[model samples]
Target: MTTTSTYDVHTVRAAFPILQRTVHGGKPLVYLDHAATAQKPQAVLDAIGHYYRTTNSNVHRGAHALSAEATAAFEDARAVIAGYVGAARNEEIVFTSGTTDGLNLLAATVLTSAQPGDEILLTEMEHHANIVPWQMVAQQRGLAIRVVPVRDDGTISVDDVASLLTERTKVFACAHVSNVLGTINPIAEWSALCQANGTRCIVDGAQAIQHCSVDVQALGCDAYVFSAHKLFGPTGFGVLWARYDFLDALPPYRGGGAMIDRVTFSGTTFNAIPMRFEAGTPHIEGAIGTAAAIRWLQEIDTTERIAHEDDLLRHTTAAMTAMDGLTILGTASHKVGIISFVVDGIHASDIGTLLDNMGIAIRAGHHCTQPLHQRFGIDASARASFALTSTREEADMFVEGLAKAIRMLR
Candidate 1:
């Protein structure tokens, strides 16, 4: 067991004012919806505000001083984000609206290279954002989409994936951690398997980036995608890190002012690897906020933060296990700070509503992974996810709230 210092949690929570706010008729807010989107700290908020106030100008077009300053700040944010993800160069990092946009870009670009018989491999536990785009591309390109089945425990089997791969497999897209099941996939081993089988691996890191350390190069993945909102940053911003050679080979997803080299009436040459993908003006302030969010996380000892969340998870798990009619989902040995479960004789939405009345925010429904819910023979689940600022008291309150809701419903 990792021993955590109490002061770290206290100090970290203090930086997030939303965690201290009261809601729902003056009740204290117990936010357990970090998986969907994390609340930004003061630092991130200030960074966004500062950028808009002081350096509010369009990038890469104007020759004015403000344009230069804004361009520098935006590129600086890109560099910071690249460093945080352990990418070798900032040119390899492409900013998108969110993870969905990043995945869509990859699907669209890679589809151009795929032929009628080419196969794109995916896992059963993928989010709709990761699944739907590829399906659309496959339909248009006459490509085959193969799904790797998950075990009864909700974790994907590498052997099943190995069996599905062949010489025709062109792309292997999967999630690092399932948003619904909280199962952390074996990404490194899976990437190696894909490499051995001549498949390009794309990892959806939306759920994994907030809880664990992510190093794109170290993971040996062809591409990695994650959203900033899930990591205590602003929405409308995400990252896609790809190998330079692969990114260079792929055609541009979009073409516009910033992504062009020479625009003639007959033809137009595209820009470099990242700029080729970034077609228009991006979310400038969002990028600044994301950089600030990463800096804030870097300041904290990640080991301690992980340990704190694990303690809360353990306590919550024990309480859920003690309940007579409750069945917890996703029993992967390695998971992050998320718990999804169903109470007997009650719908997940009812539990979510009851908890909301008590100023506790949780998520209920398929969680953007309807196929996963169907696989488990469940319509939905109530999820309570934690973060660095979550505490044991909040976990206890969640359990109590659930108990109250169960009894009332019964």
Candidate 2:
């Protein structure tokens, strides 16, 4: 798996300062937990610091100069994010605390509109963020929940999803990519199926946006949600992109100072599409830093970045596959740069602990897809995921460390 493209991974690594730091008794850090959250670059850090240093003011309310500047920067960031995701308009991109906050907000508002006996479709590979919110809504509203099963190969068939989209299905929520398996779900096909069945298609894109290109308009999904932290930006901020018409029809998810059109003793009218959902003081610096991250990533060639990650995935997978008594969990033809695996006669936690002592960071346990783990007949799996900044050297280090751990445990 060689890449012809000239992607300078060292340059990419230099951008993230933490990658240079040694950890746990002076060992070089080999970060393979990117599926959990990506490390931030210097540009993102500078953007956040600059905001507090110079333009520290509330957005969209005050008449002062600082307020106006802050508002301009905030909205400009929104436009940049909207363009990145192929949104129809900036108004359609609603800011939330994170992917979890956005999905919970959707469940509490839009999904709540379903009547009793209505069906909500989901998949087995969904993270708890996607599952629990819908479960809570279904329980409260008397809506029935249906799940598309994950096959033995860790992929779900488009036909299987089509079979589950019934006339009673009001919402079909699925992940753009599985956090554990790295299987890239066929979102466009599923979205089309939901369209014909008159169901709202909701996508959890927390894992997809950073690894590959995402176009909400091209996918034709009703809504897409993702987090900034997963994209090398600050935590506690994300975007929920939806059709403007759909957003305009829904009532406000929360009530606060910035989300009002008019307020009186009688009744109050709400603000516009995005602001209506973003109640109270928003994460101002978080939005600005996210924009910086988006710009930094865009500066790199997309083809080269993706190819670098794929190369790492192939190289690592080949090395691990040749090792005895180890099984790769997901064999989906379509995948991102993630590998979940388990060794014979060893607990995933023990593997993680040993890797930590070597200054290698990998996720151990269910990876937030407990049902997916159950589907595989395992309680947990160890995951080593890659990013554009990850290197072959790091992959080799991780493999050597894993082999040593296995020998010691066995």
Candidate 3:
């Protein structure tokens, strides 16, 4: 961790125009629901607008100059994203609609290799995006599904995962970070374990990508998936990075325009690695915007921004812990900036509603991890998640607003 000497929260917040807006009753908005989708900065918005104004053309099809320019920009975005995630090569990166789309794509193609009685292993803390796809695939493939249970503190142990893995386990899908609990799972060790057990390891990195630097090669997972919206980029765009060999070996998820090569009425052959996975006209502007967002974040002092977020987490956590009848859901030793809590005898919805009335945005629900919520013996929780641009003042406001909300509810 480094000191926040060069990073200024106010300066960073100014880059996001949404931060300056007023919500309910003329109150200033204190946006804290970053885990849902981060607010985009002006740099990303400018990039998208510039692309539409100057270079709006389909890629890889036309022989004209505009098409050539669009093609170069799109591929350059891929290279930038690949480097940001520490992928071994650019060809391994496949653009998808979002994380859910990527996971479903992998589930459909990867599970085709499993036989009856083959197992698909997952952790109890996975988001529905990670769980439902594997379940759908297992049902189709005659494969069994197994889950590694989370401990009381909302953390999963490597040993628990090892105990569950067997020769029959064909795939291990887990999250790099828990969206609700903020627990950072041990991905590297688990990936190594999956390799030793001859199981393919897939990581859901939707929640982790914005907060931490990801190295798919270092983690040694067969595939990693995340959405661009969570990283202050546009929604409806994401990246799925797999080992080039693994991706080349799997069948294509969907077949259509760009994914084909030498198509004819008699027979058709598919294109190479990434294009084979990306079937339609790609999100050309979305790619440009995502690359711009990644570049904008890189311009900041990473260590200082990380320290600032950590301070927000510590301050908010300490304040919430001191409140009566308030219980934080997850107490994992390591976590990102997300914090979920429940108030005694008060519905989580009520807390969120009152917070919204006070012009504070927070999320209240199972957060797409109903199973994890069930494990915690609750149906829903109030979650306040932070981003790199979030301020200590906003965290203080949340703590203060939450206290008032609890009082009024009580």
Candidate 4:
């Protein structure tokens, strides 16, 4: 179970109880869908359960000691995440339901300052979370949505995005890493270009945060968005870290109890930056768990972890590509430990089903990048995304399962 010169992966695997058992019959679960959602580790689970059992209370509202404790822990979690992403201030980090909610909140809030002729630039490799919210708002505001094209190798150039920018371009948003293609977008380069053009830059870090280090100030994006669950935390929790300048002026996305300051029959005032955007009772335990996930990540030698993942990527790519008629999609040189492939004359869903029967979980279909799939002339592709605990054996199992599936299908 030891990978590379990296630390013991078996030790890491021991932290995840679910990795212990087999799924159907005696088949070990080769969970390769980390890009979709990561399995929570024991630290995350313990943090959440401990919170609900020991300090359950309504944060920022209640008067008692339990409430104060919960509030402090929740805000502390925000600070941890803010530091993790290198945000300028803790107030810049706003908690949302997930990546979908974070992107929607940001898009809605920023639209409050939009004019009729504004343009929002997005890349073709963006997840639907980054595309749909902008599309909905653009439709309503008469704004235009322009896409930065992806290359045949599943990578994008900053020059391509810059070519599309103009005086009318108010915002440029892109995913830091593509979920399907695993292309690592040059966010800092594009952010610098957008800033020079007087445009706001946003980065969707859902896929990037888990794979590599992300410093928002270093990335120089006006805003950044990511989900905690994809990084080994609880679902229903995400972070949207915006620049300090945008935090004060962006309008609130929802109206509810905690987000408001004063209410009147005629008009109501709102709370400060983050609280204004985070409405209703927040997920207190979810926040705590997310902090634990980040803490666990920090505990590991990240260099070693990344090296292990890179080894997995290289191994999987070689094994899968060695099979005849099996084509690996998105052969970007800078991709992370995710492999998307298609077997000729075989359906992706069938491959997924057969793998599932073998206790192997992978993502199938377009992976929410239908436009990318369309560009590649494929309706779907089978994706096996690696995580911290992924090993050479699991990679071999995945390739062997797919080979068996392809033989049967053909």
All predictions: root-mean-square deviation over Cα? 1.2, 1.0, 1.2, 1.3
Candidates sorted by TM-score, best first: 2, 3, 1, 4
**Cα lDDT of model 2 by residue, 98-216, tens digit:** 99998998888887568899999999999999999999999999999999999988899889999999999999999999998899988999999999999999999999989989999
- How high is the CA lDDT of each candidate model? 0.91, 0.93, 0.93, 0.89
* Count of clashing pairs, candidate 1: 0
Off by over 4 Å in 4: 1-4
Q: Per lDDT, what order, best first?
A: 2, 3, 1, 4
Instruction: Write down the worst ten-residue block by lDDT for model 2.
Output: 1-10
Estimate, for each residue in 253-360, the C-alpha lDDT of model 4 and write its tens digit.
Answer: 899988999999899999998899888999888899999999998999988888888888987888877899988877888878888888888899999998999999
Window of ten residues with lowest summed lDDT in model 3: 1-10
Clashes of each: 0, 0, 0, 0
TM-score to true structure, per model: 0.98, 0.98, 0.98, 0.98
Model 4 residue 301 lDDT? 91
Top lDDT model: 2
Q: Which regions in candidate 3 have their CA more than 4 angstroms from the true location?
A: 1-4
Instruction: Compose the digit string of candidate 1's lDDT tens values, residues 1-410.
Output: 23536436778999998889999889999999999999999999999989888999999889999999999989999999999999988999999999999999999997686789899999999999999999999999899999998787778877898899999999999999988778889899889999999899999999999999998877999999999999899999999999989888889887787889899999999998788988889888888899999999999988778888888888899999999799888878888888999888899999999999999999999899988888888899999999989877888999999999999999
Indicate the residue-level lDDT of 210 in model 3.
90
Ranking 2 against 3 by lDDT, winner: 2
